[model samples]
Target: MARTKIIAGNWKMNKTVAEATSLVEELKKELATFEAAAVVLCPPFTALVSVARLLQSAPRIQLGAQNLHPAPSGAFTGEISAAMLREAGCRFVIVGHSERRRYFGETDAFLREKLLAAVAAGLRPIFCVGEELPDRESGRWPAHLRSQLQGALSGLSVDALSQIVLAYEPVWAIGTGRNATPEQAEEAHALLRKELEALHGATVASKMPIQYGGSVTPRNAGELLAQPDVDGLLVGGASLDAGSFTSIVFAVQ
Candidate 1:
């Protein structure tokens, strides 16, 4: 079976509800023109309800959330829950993103609970795992990635695992106008596959999608997509622009 290429745009902290709707309107006009990767738009939580309402008429595009709180409900302050996202029309939620880890100090333990919450709420989890510049420079990134993958997803059922879309975003590359070459990205993706095989079986591991996230633009999209192991892209900056994001999506062809 061919894995569906997922092009998830993490519109982190950008765009108001109105701006998001306008962008989605632009995307709706053009997204259907390309039979490219499955397109997911992740606006800030504030825009989800509005964006979700718009997406009802434009079914080609999917809605996702940048993040979610682990609990269904509680006194978690200003955090939103997976159930709330579900009601807001989110089909997917990103967990363990480098930004969350770096800025908020989210740990693997917390991410595991978030993943479980997402799965329970019938939302797919886009689990982000990656290394920082220091880890890569020390040549310990593979080990770092493995620990994140295993340590976070250790006891998930096969069903829950299937709902996951793993995104590898090297901290050094994200939003820095730099990216891992196709070869380097492929190597990391291949290593992730190996790690999955060890945790699950080869059959299960082979079917999972491993997406690369970083400074992915139309210029490098085609080459990166051409690499056999790179199943999709968790796009950032380029995705903020409808034209550029569409170009990157078409590069999958």
Candidate 2:
């Protein structure tokens, strides 16, 4: 089963509506005819509506949201719900990002509900899992990664699990200008695939796309994408500019 490459740009916290519109306008032109990989642009909540409108013309590129609350209609102030994101024209939503773990104190148990909500609302989740610098140094990254996958996905139905796209973003490397070598990225992605196989079955696991994130630049995107298990990228800073992001997309070969 050949999984299509999915290159998603997580424009976390940056990009006002105006800035997001400008960037997507450029991306629409550059990626208008690109069909090698699936491109997803995750803008901040504030820009979703505007970006969604802009993307109507660029049908190949999909719209995604940075995060979503589990509850459908919540009293949770400052939280966006899956239904809201869906109505905003988001086909995808990022779940369990490391920043949400570190800053907002999102737990795997909590994220499980988020996954349920996302799928129930017909939104595919870009579920992020990774280790911090200390965990990597202590050689506990494998166990840490396993814990994250199992903790959130243990009891999910095959239908639910099928809607997920996993992203391996080393906490230390994100936004630090340092990236994992292609070998290192492959090792982590392979481990994640193995874990998924155990939790689900080989057929289901093989169909799932596992993406690599963390300081991914156009210069390194090609080598990283060359890894067998590294299906795509969850780009950060490099995705801010349309030119650089387009270059990363064109690196599919």
Candidate 3:
């Protein structure tokens, strides 16, 4: 089966409720022309309810969460659970983003728990696996990513694994304005697919979509998506603006 292209916007730590609503409205209008790809918008937690309500009738564009806690409910202050996210109309949640790892001290073990929680809650988890610049420069990118993948996806059954959407986000490129070349993205994506195949078998791995998320923009979307192993993209800064994001969506379409 051919993997469906997913163009997801990571509005990380930006956009108020009103801003999110406006963005969603604009996306609904612009998305009408591009229905071939799955467009996901992940606004801040404060904006999920409003965004969800606004997109209640617009199913083409899905709502996602930037992060989620591993436990369903707990005294973990400042954290939201997977069930809570699902209730807010989120169909997906991003786990192990580099920012979280770098700033919040999230570890692979914690990410594994969160991935399981997201899966158990019936929410598709976009498991982010990537390497930092130093790791890449040291020729340890593959080993690092592979290790993270294994640890994060430790005990998931093949059936559970099938629901996962892997993202290959190079830490150095994210939010740095230094995007990876199409060839570079393709190489990483291909390697990621190979790793998945080793753990999940070709049949399941082939069906799983691997997305690139590192300074992706409309100008480069077409070339990036054209790569054989590049199934989709996890857009960041460019996705915050409706016009720019829609342009990227249409490019994929």
Candidate 4:
């Protein structure tokens, strides 16, 4: 069975509410009848509600958040809960993005909690995992990726995993004008699928959707998506612009 492609744009730390609205309005116009892939736009936390409001009229497009707190609610100041995100009309939320892991020092144990929270709150999670340049060069990427995957997904049930989309964003490539080659992307994606099969089973792993990120653009999107195990894309900077983002969305066609 083929998985429906997903094109999720992670507008990290960019776009005020007004700018976000304009971008989505442009996206709505271009993707009015577009249904080639499931589309998700993740804006900054401050813009989620406003973006959600705009997305209400465009059901084809879905709203997502860049991050969320693992706890439902608490004294954890400066945190947004999954329940809050759901109430704001977010159908999806990104968890354990590389930046979060790097800048905020989020551990895999903590990411697992966030995944559980997101699912429990009825929001799908786009869980990210990847290795840095040194790891890749030292041939430690396999071990690093395995650790990240096992650490975060160890005890999760297959049912819970079903509600998640896995993303592979090479740390060195993100926002650096570098990206994995189709062959490299395929190798990594295939490994991830194999690992999933080991954790669950062939049936479950085969049905899961895995995405590639890191400096993706219209020029290279088509070739990247052509890889057998590469199911979708997790777009970043290019996604901030309506035209470029739309081009990347339709690149496969």
Give TM-scores for every candidate, taking all chains together and pairing residue i with residue i: 0.98, 0.99, 0.97, 0.99
Q: Write the per-residue lDDT of candidate 2 for residues 179-204, one digit (tens) a residue.
A: 99999999999999999999998987
| Candidate 2 backbone collisions, by pair | none
User: What's the lDDT for all of these models?
Assistant: 0.91, 0.95, 0.90, 0.94
The Cα error of candidate 4 at residue 45, in Å, is 1.0
For candidate 3, lDDT tens digit of each residue in 38-153? 88889999999999998887888899999999987879999999999999999999999999999999999999899889988999988898899999889999899889988877
Q: What are the per-residue Cα lDDT tens digits for candidate 1 across 184-205?
A: 9999999998999899878768
Model 1 scores a TM of 0.98
Ten residues in a row with the worst lDDT in model 2?
66-75
Which residue pairs collide in model 4, if any? none
lDDT for model 2: 0.95
Note each model's CA RMSD in angstroms. 0.9, 0.7, 1.0, 0.7
Per-residue lDDT for 202 in model 2?
Answer: 99
lDDT of 1: 0.91
